[model samples]
Target: MKTFKLLSPFVLLLILIVSCSSVSEPESAVNELQVSNSLTEVEVDSIASTLSLFPNGTQFSIAFISDTAVSFYGAHRIDDDLKNTDNHDRVFEIGSISKVLTSTLLAHAIHDSIIREDQTVRSALDIEMAGDPEFTFLQLANHTSGLPRLPGGYTLNFLWNMNNPYKNFDAQELKTYLKDDLIMPRDPGETHRYSNLGAGLLGLFLSELENSSYENLLQKKIFEPMDMSRSTTDREVIKDYLVTGLTKRGSSAKNWDMADLAGAGGVLSTAEDLSRFIQANFNPDDPVLSLQRDSTFQVNDSMDIAMGWFILNRDSGDRWYWHNGGTGGYRSSVVMDPEQKTGVVVLSNISAGHSEADKIDRLSFDLMKMHFAN
Candidate 1:
């Protein structure tokens, strides 16, 4: 009986070991996809199913990439009369994502010894201002500038005729606003507030410093070097692939001309091109959009606002750097995990439907955990 009891315990131990091994073997054998080709059919299906939970008429293109690999998915409502052509290369206006590009260009300018972050805005531009002379370029780029979200005295007529009210305001007008009637929203650098006007002003300052058009500078410094062939500040380059812009709530789509605010929300891009850019950001050796610094700027504890990238901290303790864009009818997002060297870029033509960008962002994090969690 004693021998039998000992034998039974040993048998049970062996069985448990075998069972655990059996359970874990497949998971161990299942390789996690790299940045180059991480999203498989199963992954894509999962993402599509999650996205379908949103409303109809919504369109989105997503790309996931790791250090050396990439995978993508493109989806839209079937009943919506929209067609996906060159879906990978289809150019859509990336709204705030332009800020990321702009910030990258500014960083390049600093690398080339063109401008310094601590330099005052007055040093870069000859514009007059009514606010304090203490406002610096860093303040403007980081949204620490006390400048209002929009320049003072802007009228609806400006928006109607200009399509973008701030676009038509020239350096002379900006000077007037500063010199005659600028109002400080808050003390400079006291808090973080997003200001489209502040970013636009930085673009204007760069243009003035270079003594060239913003479009020309962006092409020569960023687009050409990065091989962003389809990315363009010029409307002419993307005119062919331009999807009509839509209102946030209405059916009628309008063409938003960035003639005035071109620097802030002007550049048009595709998922394929943006993915390449994001990869370059992760690995700066590519000679495209490189990260010159070891660390980017963090906004308190919530997000890291790098030169052009925003880092989001997940509940699972994972860090993701991302940015979203929305023009009239176009919406897009770019998310990346520098640690795993994995990232995702999503673009959409219709803006009124769902927060697909945010959804894709969370999904990217979840997928990373699913495939890579140890």
Candidate 2:
């Protein structure tokens, strides 16, 4: 729910213009019907090639849906001899994107009357606060909890083991940090500053409150109902199906295991399953996922972070909710235009290699504009 620090208003505006430009080109009245007919025959490969420009050695998959149909593209690495048979079902670690899922579970808990959005962190987790006691679940979900980006001792351990600094932290360590050494970067709810620690702690608290593991809670409330059969927290479940996540150079693959902080960077899913999730998000009436839109926390005067999803206002006055994820070798993104009844899900086995996630998000927007402009 934290606003991406790198996105400036001007940058977002530019991105919007570039993404939607094709939709606004004027068609001659004489040839309008002909142009529209030709547009439907546009090649998917052309779009795929445009997406390929951003990532290096990127093996990506995309799934998209509208009111009546679903489509898939680019299952390159997923089917090759480079990986095993279950590779198609292998769950790639979705990094920060896990935050969205964690946030959703928390929201569902709140909606179920199991927890309160305004509940103080201390009360929810039953621990002494080392910093601000006024912080609430909403603040944590929105990344305004003022908690440092990482635990206090993370840097000390990370200096020696950058690949697995967080691997050493457990619930006991987090509790100790909270009681003995935590500090807020600023006043809670002051501004948007992303904190993995904040989101991680939130997940811990939610799991404790529900009297169930975060993994189980998500399965019951989100995944199972949506029929995301291939999504799982157990690494072994997708072990044989796993795709090797490639580094930018395509030299080799790196696997990241965020043991205790699994809520922050755990869970693997396939493009097909993710597409279903995206569809449910856009059309909440599906009986699988329910989205409640409340303007409780506003971001940038117009947009809001509802539960774990982001609400963005388009130039045409339409709003969309979306999120993205990345880990060591994988990147993923989901976006939905609720008013237009359209959505997209993109997953890749390469990290930042070709900017695959961003390209898919842009292309989805372009496609949605074309679908809805009429």
Candidate 3:
């Protein structure tokens, strides 16, 4: 969808049009994509070489991990500003990757018996829906909930403040939209259409069910348990360590505040912590974790919907469950093979155009393909 095209390109552009600074010289950085035949890195140098090409100096962190081992890399710096370099610990807005975490929360609620899989939107929240009343929580989690990608009134605010459209879209406004402006356009569970409103509303409903804030619920259920100490939904927490994202023209780009839509694309994280999050998905003790990856709906021949992940059928039937996120200036990606217990996490400060951002996404898949090929 064009909405996805505009927002979900997570990280560096592959094309040469944008100029960025290299954090370190190629020779000094780990420029190799291949580590071995079974888990070789492909075009790693090519990826590393483009590091400096980001006009605002890209700050990125990547990790490749399997059941047996892990490899990590980080480049944190401002373009052409050697004196102002940071490290992997610096935080970046993770954009929509927050969805995966929200889904994880949904899984936890199901696991804890706080919410039922059969619960419908009309019963869960204050929404006055005009469509199928039987639209279940399962449908919402898998994005089969017939809701539009955005609330009906979102377009005007988006046009008025492209940089920070959601800044004014707080909890009260979201409730207003749900009660007054919602109109179901498709039959629930008919097809897979991504909906930020649906996902964010799910978070809100879950939060109310738990009698706590979304951030607090996540902290108790996932972040603290997994030791993702640096991750947070509150912008104030990561403010000191946040990287400054840049625009196409190399000007400072505005960071977004998601207001009520925080569940959709509002969280800050680091690569190291995300790697741990992915690794935890393979832990057998975590039954709820697997629920997030369980197939919920079919999207197409190559893709399916799992709680919040896009399940791609790749490499002779291996499933690549992943999600990507982007806001005004930042983009992020996370992909993993639950079967292989292998995954990659990339976070960048620049939101290059779609083609470049897509290249960054492809590079992650390439990393996995190398492993599967062997």
TM-score of each: 0.77, 0.77, 0.83
lDDT of residue 226 for candidate 3: 66
Q: Write the per-residue lDDT of candidate 3 for residues 131-195, one digit (tens) a residue.
A: 43557777878899888888885667676776876776777878777666778778788888899
> Which portions of model 3 show Cα errors greater than 4 Å?
1-42, 49-53, 76-86, 126-134, 352-355, 371-373
Top candidate when judged by TM-score against the true structure? 3
In angstroms, give how far residue 349 of model 3 lies from its true place: 0.6
Q: Rate the local accuracy (lDDT) of all candidates.
A: 0.61, 0.61, 0.70
Candidate number with greatest lDDT: 3
Worst 10 residues of 3 by lDDT: 15-24
Error of 3 at 206 (Å): 0.8
Greater lDDT among 2 and 3 belongs to 3
Summarize candidate 2's per-residue lDDT along 54-115 as a digit string, tens digits: 33345556555554445554434221111112223446666777877788777687777777
State the lDDT of candidate 1 residue by residue for 1-374, as single tens digits.
Answer: 11111112112111000000111122221123233233344554555555454444555666655544555555555443222323666677788788877877677777677877678877766777765556777677677777777666564554565334444566666666678988887887676677777877778778888888888887877676556778887777678876555454435445555554566777888777776666555543432244432234567777766565666777778777777776657667667776666666767765523344456456655655554454
Ranking by lDDT: 3, 2, 1
lDDT of 3: 0.70
Error of 2 at 53 (Å): 3.9
